[model samples]
Target: MALYFFRISQGRYSGASDQPFEFDSREAAWTEMTAVCSNLLSGISRGLRPNSEWRMEMLDERRKPVFCIRLTADTLD
Candidate 1:
């Protein structure tokens, strides 16, 4: 199983750290949050520019940090 990350900022959600909530895959995460995430992305697209090449570090199966998939505009809070 692969790991994926989801996050929201302080003002974005009633949560801590703004850190990621991990999943086994992007599809899995999206499936669990389809309605909410889709709506948020649609709203953000109305204002913010799309980030086609966003990047971030994440841990792999070996527990070593490595550059993973480029984040989509979907990561926006």
Candidate 2:
């Protein structure tokens, strides 16, 4: 298993995960990240702080960013 970190950023507000999660592979970690992003988006839709620049960054054990998922509120007709 390997350790991974998730850092959340919403505009000027940012926070880091206090504990790391263990995953067997990067693919697994990516899957988890998607779930997390979905939850956060739900919160926003439910009257949580709406942020146009909300994003989650995935980092490896060495603290290097592997990928980032950005969420934006765009109006569609």
RMSD of each: 8.5, 2.8
lDDT tens digits, residue span 1-77, model 2: 99999998876888878799999999999999999888778776564354366779998888789889987765555
Supply every candidate's count of residue pairs whose N, Cα or C atoms clash at under 3 angstroms. Answer: 0, 0
Worst 10 residues of 1 by lDDT: 9-18
Off by over 4 Å in 1: 1-5, 8-28, 50-77
lDDT of 1 by residue, 1-77 (tens): 56534434322332222344566775665565555455565555465446433323344344444333333554566
Count clashing residue pairs in model 1. 0
Best by lDDT: 2
lDDT scores for all predictions? 0.44, 0.83
Model 2 alpha-carbon drift over 4 Å, by segment? 45-51, 74-77
Q: What TM-score, over all chains together, does every model reach?
A: 0.30, 0.80
C-alpha positional error of residue 5 in candidate 1 after TM-score superposition, expressed in Å: 6.5
